[model samples]
Target: MVWKLPLHESGHPENELTAESDGAVIRRTVLPGGVRVVSEQLPGQRSASIGAWVNVGSRDEQSGHFGSTHFLEHLLFKGTKRRSAMDIAEAFDAVGGEANAVTGKENTCYYARVLDTDLPMAVDVISDMITSATIDPAELETERGVILEELAMNDDDPGDVVHEQFSAAVLKGHDLGRPIGGTPDTINAVPREAVWEHYQEHYQPETLVFTAAGNIDHDVLCADISQALKVGGWDLTPGVAPRARRDTTPIVGLGQESVEMTIHRSVEQANVIIGSTGITATDDRRFQLSVLTAILGGGMSSRMFQEIRERRGLAYSTYCFGSSHVGTGTFGLYAGCTPARIDEVTELMVGELEKMADSGITPAELERTIGQLSGSLVLGLEDSGSRMNRLGRAELVTGELYSVDESLKRIREVTAQEVQVLAQELASRPRSIVRVGPFGS
Candidate 1:
């Protein structure tokens, strides 16, 4: 018997069986011009979720194109050459389906959920938006205001503001540090020509990945994508392969050390985020870090939760969070507490990190964290939308798909020693501290 590795995104054959386990069958098909289609079929599922992932994101924005990637995501659904915005909305509503788009640091996804029979329609509508958006000047102006309002809404939340500030401070000079939606200045300055140029340059067949799960036929889905894309004026030239996975080499001079800043907001509670540079998305130590994060502040029983909330009643919410990108990541702890308790909470948070760095999780803590992560990993994929998201991310970011059991195995294999080492490394890194509250100027 021979052991074979899973198929990767860059150079797999035209069609392949990517993974099969228990009752789910996952497959992949590469179309002309590097368009990739991946799908998973759950035998008994009646609902299907589909996602069209474009390889462009905020980090890909050029000098004048800041926020254009996310702005383009909004523009796509505004209207396409073949359908009006209202028509697009009604198409999904009439079928009782849900559709939306998400623009992240590294990619954008337009996704929908509907009955299995409506999968083709979902694909057609989303593909049309992706390929043939008119980017009408009037509609662009309208969406600009909407996005500005959206940004304003986010600014109103101290927690969101704090986290955004933390990223900007930590990643300081990096493109990844910029907000996904762009700042008000950039959004207002980004002319229509810049956005259209961005659209024409990045939204090519080689830069798109299509994925779906739940009652899907891989070949049929690929065909549907092909037909819809061709109708929308895409050139599906043969022999092209999908773009390679994101390079994981750490971007040079991208992180700042020991930076701290405070913003005054007229809020009763202070929101604080203390974080530092962490692991990349492809780093094998992500599993260990996952365990480490969970034990530190993942849930109610987590150390941060128990100590900060249950023991002292200092804060109503406390948690540790992390974000992993191609070659860099951010790890931090967040707590919202009364303004008077800000210093005390910050001290405790730093103290807890030092403790973990010095000593390590106990055997019991390790066991509980493994179980917690395993359960969440499996439970999060219980729906078709989650499954579709998993496929799209695997194909877009990591380039390889791991089965649920394989993912669980990796999580369970994380050792206490590994987690401690990761913690120590994280603690040693210079930290970035951000606070948002009504502390006197």
Candidate 2:
């Protein structure tokens, strides 16, 4: 069934049954410092997945803290008050559990998966890292070199560069356009103190969300996290609320009708991306956009794949993609092909999108796309990690959570007309094109 966004009203209840259906149960508990403990119980599972989601990312970086969000992501795992870096690493290695973190434009997550018995240890370790990262000056210096190398590695890939350029062209003058891994210049300029200040400012209890899935008991998990955070020295005083939802005003582009950018790179294959700003995270037409995306370039049978690869053999890979954020999102298609055929591939990609907008998908295509999206959603939730991600992202990002079945229903109900309407809107928006390859040798 459909679930409403969690209540963020001041003095929200300490415990609430967010959603329950079939054999699965979902519950949420708010702690003294506004730390949220949300969990889903899946019977007959021996493993559990947990994540500590912080509601800040590169987009939230202040003047001196560019790239510090991702920087902290690495530093947290370096050491904590109680556990050394090696101790943290060995803790998971000894148990055969997996742990990692991701820094996104909007949030950062430190997550892990382990046997049900080891959930407590996992919780304690991640909580320690989140609340007690030492961020040693020496360690920060070392990671600086490491992050610089990471940025270099990313720049080495033309496919990656093209997408980055496309975002810069589309979301020009916006924080979202900046690379998540800050540029080398920015990284070198940011002082260790800047990172420390960033950590202290954003890593508050109210900005933290703890979510777990599989063979989990809500109350036990909440108590464990409370003790862990307390040991890590977070203020647990009562009367605080979780961070408010991000403002939902749509961010529009401020430029001419279209923009084209080309970066000269010595690469065998040219990479290209053509797209435009699309929708917001809370847009109602997201389901329709999904259907349209799949129909145009999602898979082997998709129009772009069939024409660009199967029929013409102009490219080795071609696909469509979209990313949504609080205010604006991106919609684009990419292809890596022989430099000689770049023009043909670009035309084909644009033509496919235009065709879809001019003439909506047939009934057969609509049915197939709906099934494709529905099956993908169901299959992705077969494990605890995926379910944990669903819960965490729903609570953190859109603030709305839907059961697997409910999500499937939404996809299935998208009408072809709706998909066409979205396609027409996206097609009409000003486009940005980014090309990366050797042009004049």
Candidate 3:
């Protein structure tokens, strides 16, 4: 996965993807294991972000092994042989930087942000942390207590619970159905040996991607990644997983799904979420969905805010969001409204979606949607964390990288017909509804 100078863009970059760094050179490096590295270096920005991305996530876990990835995330934060967790936290904080990681449907990311001058320091710690950190017995026990509290907190909050539960329902029989934070029953059941076993199999650097953005020299970064690969190799086997089947999936209306999330501490406001699975991470149509989401619920001028709140005062919050992954994704709508107005509000929201289904958006709406999405993409890329994410995720999902221009182009070229198609497909999914709050009748 090494590239020579003047490396040409691989796939056609999206036309509207104007978010690239002018000074940046996109490159790839193949390390010892099959790890692939991709990046864009922006010399003008003062900061750099480096991250280790593993394609394995909670969705890849075996039954009874739920939340193992997230649990593993906690264990990583505990002291390693070289540094105590406190020491690690302090080291980053002392430098005016932040270090963090998260587990998702198809990937787990460990990232660090720092001054461009400290780029080597950034890579050194992340490389060592991901490749050689020891999972000591004492630290494991202490971390379990921390993770249990985290799980309890999730259980006690309906807003969170409904999303987790809804995920379970949508990805049923699939590893993705399980919560990223394991239940006490499962977590307590998993022994120390199993955690180690999972790590041994999943944490292969060959399947990993390391990325850096801002003030990075492509050659120097490639050299750093090569060194990390030499440190993390193991007896590797080729990885492959068949896509799960969803042949009989229904176009379930909101009423058909049982979604009751009640919190005892009653308040005037309640959050209602409607969502379901729609696309894969690699689907080209996702760009359209991004644009459509902005047009439908992105800001005050967006349809949901204009129609649901401004005109009727039906809710305080309203938005549409899309979550995409290597093989699957979820699209959702969320709003906080008066419990007394839930029925009216739900109907109004449904009408908006239905209107899109029947009458595709006008040309002006489509253009505005693309503009907002393109601007948002550019703004997000200014951060090292976000840049590293974009690079790593592109490698993991498509086995290729996209330029900022490519992304913008995809968004720009999305026709009203495509948005209509996406809308129709989204509306057709088994629409699960979750409502949490008071309704005194």
Candidate 4:
């Protein structure tokens, strides 16, 4: 009695078991065991990309288990019931493909890219890792040190530390503010049992979405997944819907006045991030914000680039960015400059943002940014890996999918007035400022 979910981007009744297309056929099926398989078929492609997206991340961790999510990510690849770590690695190497995984704020994905002929092996290896990992205590202890070393390496990078500090300051008192790797202290405290418990609870078939793109046949991929799941003894009965945690708490207090902090480091250059709260991932205003970001600091011709680097020669790198999560986001400018010019760089960066907000972008800027956004969007998806990511993220995170044409039309429809209104709102939000450099220079 499995049924397909709605296919039309707009809301529609769910009755059919599949949706068909000529260029890209998107198919979704709820396996008898509750696992949802969603994939796209591109007729002439040679390479295939597949991902196992789990709906859990660092933000979902309870107290005393800070780095458990990321810790699990490492252990999953260590070994499975039937394959040793080396065997798993060599399986992909034999197929001339690459396998890796990443832990995000709200989800974790294990993916592989391989020729279409080798997709079955890719599917089998990834599925085994997800469903049958041993999570051995000895392996956990070894990887714990590896993860700690990684964190220390991140601490040594000023740019990385400042961005992390900025997030902590802006998202103070919120789970989203914490680093994805969790602090070293928390990582050390997480026992092997806790890691196993987190995995069992969150890695259910009902909470996972399997996605593939490139020269793939959705039906074939689905069959392979069904067989692989059976190997791990996952029940193929109908399962429950994924659990949703809606966090609508606004970032309070920090938005009233600019909150500033500085970390003194004996670095050659000062890394600074001047940013404030912005829109969420699902907000309609995201399109407008995209245009504003590009115009302000997205490229070499952007205002931030021309003003800070080209004209004033203040920095070799200066750009603005916007990041959106489920309930909230941030928009900020980052610049690395000589320690002597820290004050001047901050002033100029802030001045440009104020000017843009106060007066809005010019006609030329709007048109150029729109074109740039349009090109970048289309160009970025010119591969199976990109398409696979788009499919996976849309299904697992956004819960909605957009055709390329639909996306381009939305970007083209953004108007100057829309950008201005959104820019003003962004500028009016409280700002969070972070600086990392040597003090008393």
Off by over 4 Å in 3: 1-21, 228-268, 439-441
Q: What lDDT tens digits, residue by residue, belong to model 2 across residues 164-225?
A: 88887888888998888899999999998999999999999988999899999888898899
Candidate 1 residue-wise lDDT, 286-338, digit = tens: 88888988899999999999999999999999999879999899999899999
Q: How many clashing residue pairs, candidate 4?
A: 4
For residues 162-238, write the lDDT of model 4, one tens digit per residue: 99988888877778889999988998999998999999999887777788888888778888998998897786664
Clashing pairs in 4: 32-236, 32-237, 33-236, 33-237
**What's the lDDT for all of these models?**
0.88, 0.88, 0.69, 0.83
Ranking by TM-score: 2, 1, 4, 3
Task: Please provide TM-scores, in order, for all candidate models, with all chains considered together.
Answer: 0.97, 0.97, 0.85, 0.94
* Candidate 3 per-residue C-alpha lDDT over 259-292 given as tens digits, one digit per residue, 9 for 90 to 100: 4444432556777777777676667677788877
lDDT of 3: 0.69
Clashing pairs in 1: none
**For model 3, the run of ten residues with the poorest summed lDDT:** 7-16
Backbone clash numbers for all candidates listed: 0, 0, 11, 4
What's the CA error at residue 122 for candidate 2, in Å?
0.6
